[model samples]
Target: MSHLHRAIAFTATLLAAGLLQAGQVRVAVAANMAIPMQRIAVEFERATGHELIPALGSTGRFYSQLRGGAPFEVLLAADDEIPARLEREGLAVPGSRFTYAVGRLVLWSLDPHGVDPQGNVLKQLPRGRLAIADPRLSPYGAAAIKTLGGLGVLAAWQPAFLQGESVSQAFQFVASGNASYGFLALSQVMRDGRIPRGSGWIVPSQYHPPLNQDVVLLNGGRSSAAALAFLDYLKSEPARATLRGFGYEVVKH
Candidate 1:
């Protein structure tokens, strides 16, 4: 074979190798999105041939990591504001941010009678433990505090509260009976709009600001094609339907 023919063959091999190596996208996601994001990642990998590496935590912690040079290509955060800030700071790719899901807070309990959907349960439980994510750090925790205040129970329930570092941990606290009851994401308690295990109350939307979960491509200046693709997939009709089925509200805008 001529020298040119051998060179062409070698280049073809290198291109194939590069394609194989580009089949993964590292993602940093909020802990509250763990379960749903796992399901979405599975489908995304199947559809796009890109493996998702998710690092889940509170939005505040993840933001710090991203700023500290964590090698992440995507962020699925618990709120839209963080993504907006990242975009404004040029840490995230502009025009790549979009709302993925609207989170809902629920009062949940492992105890059969610890929660009542139609009753003011907090007023009845004078000293019962109420688990919540730390409002100083977690967005869900902030919402929980706001909701409690809105309902006129913040001061009365302050002494009975147990705080978790992340929303997932807060839910686990209640689920394991470490606390008699707790605030959690509605999606954590419901499947197909029905609560499966212990009792829960879906707090009225009017009680707190919307929990708008957002996704954005980090400006890692790497091959974020797959990351951007997955962001688009999250807004696809089928994906939105699946999220809604899991009790997450689909963002209209």
Candidate 2:
């Protein structure tokens, strides 16, 4: 077994023996996951009596904060690399990292006919801004660039680019009609297992690298019973179901 799994097992033993008390766990979650996390947190808190305190932002920003000694106990990142880097740097528990979800990218607009199913709207886009998250900070934003590049429209759309610090903000740019369209995480626009309104084209996964969203137990949380229990709860069926409801792909445990 991985060291983290063993540790979690031991922690479970302690809990079963009534030696551990429920407490709060501070978590850093990617902005794209904020809504789903909120739902899952409600259920988790009700079931386990453990409070989850979440800080939502871009993965890159969280990495910088963690490097600067942020006191977050767990990380649910938008991409796999940051968690891997944390493990390598000893900021997180080695072997405690795992991909919790695979993110999907979408081109979305508030108008019903704003985007075509095949995303051919880019070929003759209207004269307005095209929103995207900052590629340097958001995996979804990076995927947007890759998608445009693959379609050979990067140059054509360069002048109209409008960048947001995170995918959630990019969605806002489009949702508020400040931009004609925005590249966003599927989760941002999904509801009831589908896109509830406006128009969106789900970008094919091949357009960019797989957005393997991973979660890790940070070094600071290794000794916290609540943190350990939270990690275990994340792999439960209820949590995985919540992830899927938001259009994120979850790996079978």
Give all TM-scores, in the order shown: 0.88, 0.96
With candidate 1 superimposed using the best TM-score fit, by how many Å does residue 169's alpha carbon deviate from the native?
Answer: 0.9
Q: Point out where model 1 deviates above 4 Å.
A: 1-22
Model 1 poorest ten-residue lDDT run: 3-12
Candidate 2: regions farther than 4 A off: 13-19
Query: How many steric overlaps are in each model, in order?
Result: 0, 0
Q: lDDT score of model 1?
A: 0.79
Candidate 1 pairs with clashing backbones: none
lDDT of 1 by residue, 75-119 (tens): 888889899999998898777678889988888888667688863
